[model samples]
Target: MKNITCIEDLRQIHKRRVPKAFFDYADRGSYAEETLRANRSDMERIKFRQRILVDVASRSLNTTILGEPAALPLILAPIGLTGMQHSDGEIHACRAAHAAGIPYTLSTMSICSIEDVASSVDKPFWFQLYVMKDRGFVKALIERAIAAKCSALVLTVDLQVIGQRHADIKNGMTVPPQWTLSKFIDFASKPSWVSGVLRGKRRTFGNLVDAMKGSNVNELSVWIASQFDQSLNWKDVEWIRSIWPGKLIIKGILDVADAKEAVKTGAQAMVVSNHGGRQLDGAPSSISVLPEIVQEVGGQTEILFDGGIRSGQDVMRALALGAKSCMIGRAYVHGLGAGGQDGVATAIDVISKELSTTMGLCGVNRIEDIDRRVLTDHLQTNAVSSPRN
Candidate 1:
């Protein structure tokens, strides 16, 4: 733990500690993963304008996200099957986020139920929603989040139809992992992981278990597959707004036209994401389209950035392009998978320190002071305007 210096260090530990199926589930993307590769490559292209002889002694990372004060401009992005990465993973991640004074967003597909996380953490974390075919069940989930006092409702609008993740297909991924001789050996190899899961609050999807009272893991998977709601449209956002009655964030906006529509929906914020390249393999990277979307709707509504944020420099890049805050999924998930709660804290600390160092070197002492000026050579401008493959 003391030797862990970067998110990649945690990721290496995660791959070693967790089962291969769950580790690859968090590490890989769908189809050819072209967009997934681009998300990182494009981010790496941006270079900072290192300034010297400027007094950055009073540097501060404090900023407000969604009108709420935060220690840093970061939020934990929602990830499905998080608890599989570590036992009670959502609760542990939420607690880590709260202790750092940053908000955590719990996925609807989490192993720990909304109530489980809400009861464990004193702060009101955010809740992410995936609108299924069953409107009644969806409404019930919303009600549960409200009852749990979730600070914000993040509506994921991209995954109306599931993408073909070849890795998951090849791995035969399943909740509680399907029993096979090979799987038994894999589980046996990671005794600590098995022990933690045995002591976990629930083995299957905590939120959906009650809804699937007599169903097995296979039956639940089939049901969830059948409930993706292919007919989902913008009208549904209006419907959700009518019922949710709180801060609403429309996630998965990556185009200028959709950004306009999200602004029209009157959402408090909209995330520019490509579902972390899990949905559309050939789509543009989120950061590449961020400037255009922000230009289109920056003032009308707050724009949050998602997709492939691995470091604090990435967060600074997103903010410089007009994101109110950045959300991270795989970075912290790796930490959770590595060492549970303490690993998550380490992930946050690494990024926070990196962001502060980046700010100081770039001659900025405040979060708002970050902008295009911190960058050198207009490198990002070329990337944003260049042709996409």
Candidate 2:
């Protein structure tokens, strides 16, 4: 197998390995995909200053995130259906993150259950939640997270309604993929992927299936679609905060006004994300909106960033722009789809090495030392031209 050197390389391998339906589920964004493209392009526009004549020795990427010490200021964002990428994908990713000294976040819709990941990994991983219409189920899920020793609770405030992804509709994407002639033919082409799936017992959404009473694999998609509470508001955030005793993170905040409100809601941190551009096609990129969100809530609460972060340089750019840390969804998922556990390890190593090299080249010795001075005014102009600006 060729060495997985970057996230793009992983994506290439993933495309070749996984079925068209699963691959597109993780790869594609919502209609128009304007915000998806903008997320990456906006980050690239921020030029870094090439400083010289500085003793860049004994560099350290070491930093603390939400009171947890990390090898670097980066977190693995929660992505649903990771198991489809690889067998027990969440467990593998969480183990890789634990070994790398970074936080791994388990999604509310993950194929692996909270207990499944918690029992497999040495360190306690963070748990992400979606506010559902069933308050009893939500409460029980929080209690289960605590039982699993999850260090933090990430409440995804957006996604009241699922966005229309043409690929998913076209592919008829669902858990335990329906066996059609085309799908069987697609699966037969990849013997290695098939073997991995057969070796694992949990092939569907493990968390949700067991969490809800009288629910089975066949009812998962319908249950999830119906459970997403449309009436979720700041009052619900307060209710969640009251139940979750650990660190609280409000995810999916793109607006500065929302960030300000999040701070007021007593959240310890807020993720500046556009749901990876899966929701709100016309929304601004996370990188483009990050600076403003930071400016508004930087002092009041920690600002974590997500959306379009595909490499280590992107992580550095986000950190330099005032994000305390950054999260990646598709990058690691690509690795999981490509080669399972080894692929995820390779992905993390690639990003960490890239982060170190980029920091050295930019004359920044530590992640904490990186700031706006290291970047050019090109990002500011892009931000100004943005529709939200």
Candidate 3:
């Protein structure tokens, strides 16, 4: 217990340090959470085929995401309200990721603004955009990202409709948290988290503050719900691609039909995600659907997988299944919540070590060499056999 070794250690520590509501926000999924549970369970069921008597030294996790070199085939996924996790949470996570040689994604709904992360980190990070009905604002947002020199523009295509996470509504989740008696009492108990929150300034949604004319919480709520474009379609992607001349990544592709459509968009990459199982409760887990999507459009577009990624082996599983890279949302969030930038670094370290060691045991030294042959009996038939170049 003294030496934290796994993500669950961070999550348990995070659960005690932060308010229950925010923890639930990061940890829980949609109604019933069947898909959320499945993400992990299905991944665990994929038993690895242990190999030996092969040279295992000099293993590497280095790979490219969207053609950019990464120290590891992992990206710190964008999660909203990261600042609440541990003062300037996005900035801390960015710093940790940069140091760890992985890319960090900043969310549109992040507590820290786009500029905040841009100014804080030295290297270019990815920016995730939630298509809003306000074309004018969306255009400006794109310009801002361009101005910040964000390396990639990640277009999150899944959240046209926000799924109802029962815990969030029940907890009355809000940024610059509302101080109801129970919530206040819970918040008061965690002095470390409170200190972090108080010491920092970018508390609420920083990107929206100036854009919404510094609107208050209630007004901001109205603006958000009204702005999320419910009618987002392929036409809009063309519109965005025309305007934003940069590497484009479409997040949240779960179906073969949708994956095929996404490939035709000329997107350099697509994340196979179900919004971390937060959108549709009964939908299949990201790993479960990854192979089908790969079969549909594997070589046509770069495939990045997300949802229920807990460890380095999870990363290995995804790669063998044809994913070029994997994104960890809750895994690193647990780290961030548990110990800020240190926690994030720790999360990355744990995964990197796990991945390298797993590769050694599997007789795969280079990440690029990881193929379907390393998987158990049933998976070898469908696994990618070799990582994509």
Candidate 4:
């Protein structure tokens, strides 16, 4: 194969290798996709200042996240059905993240079970949780992560109601996708993906099946659909904090008020994400809200930025805006879909290089040196006047 140097290249290859349903499931966003498009566009709008005539040697991307050292300020965000991107996808991705000296978060809805990943990899990975109504199952899942020696627990709190992704509805996306004539024809066109799937276990939500009582692949979808508790409140967050002993992260905090609440719940960190624009179509981009959230809670808790982070420059932008670290979903998912382990490694390399190059251009030698001065916000010119003033 050719050198996959950029995320776009991986996306193209992924389109060629994975089935349409699975590819779109990872690639596309919810209705209108306004926030998704805005996430990228907003990053582009924040232009960096270029500098010259300095001995730009020995740059470092090293930083600390959640009190642990990281090779860079990037973490692999948990993406469900990672296995469908490639066989044993979660395991391979986790391995790649470990090799790169970064943290890998395994989703509660992943195709690989917690033990499956733990047994296959040497180091511990973070586990993401979506609070379910089944208190027993929730307790078991947390215990499983603990048994797996996970160092962190990321509690995703935004997806109380699943957003309507048009592509998912159109593709009839599910675990072990329904065998329709259209899907079969799509699969036929991708023989390499077909071969990989044939060699691996069935493409069901591996983490959910055989673990939750009375739930198999056939009933998995119904169970998942019913599990997410819409009545979840701050008390639930407190309950989760009380149980999970490891580092706690409250994922999906978009508002500053909610971010403060996360801190009150004793969360060590909060990921400023809009569920990657999958939950709410009109919510502001995660990057746009990072500055305020950071300004509010930076001294008290770790702030992580997630949505629309596609390059190393994006990581820098997030840090400049006060995010301690950034997480990637579609970018890494594109890499996973393209070439599995190697693809993921290539993706990390590409972003790391991009970050280094961007840092050098902006005259910043270290990741810690990046700050708001590197960015010129055009929005400042259109400031709104307060009625009280």
lDDT of 4 at 298: 87
- State TM-scores per candidate: 0.98, 0.96, 0.96, 0.95
Q: How close is candidate 2 to the true structure, as a TM-score?
A: 0.96
C-alpha positional error of residue 193 in candidate 4 after TM-score superposition, expressed in Å: 0.9
Which portions of model 4 show Cα errors greater than 4 Å?
211-218, 378-389
Instruction: Name every residue pair that clashes in candidate 2.
Output: none
- What ranges in model 2 sit over 4 Å off? 211-218, 378-380, 384-389
lDDT of 4 by residue, 46-116 (tens): 66777877666978999998989999999999999999999989999999999999999999989888988
Which model, 3 or 4, shows the larger TM-score?
Answer: 3
lDDT of 1 by residue, 195-302 (tens): 999899988898898889998889999999998999999999999988898999999998898999989999999999999999989998999998888877899999
How many clashes (backbone atoms < 3 Å, residues ≥3 apart in a chain or on different chains) does model 1 have?
A: 0
Give the per-residue Cα lDDT of candidate 3 at 351: 90
Candidate 4 at 161: error in angstroms?
A: 1.1
Candidate 3, residue 14: the lDDT equals 88
Stronger candidate by TM-score (1 vs 2) = 1
Give the best candidate by lDDT: 1
lDDT of each: 0.92, 0.87, 0.88, 0.86
RMSD to the hidden true structure, all candidates: 1.8, 2.0, 2.6, 2.4
What are the clash counts of all predictions, listed in order? Answer: 0, 0, 2, 0
Best by TM-score: 1
Ranking under lDDT, best-scoring first?
A: 1, 3, 2, 4
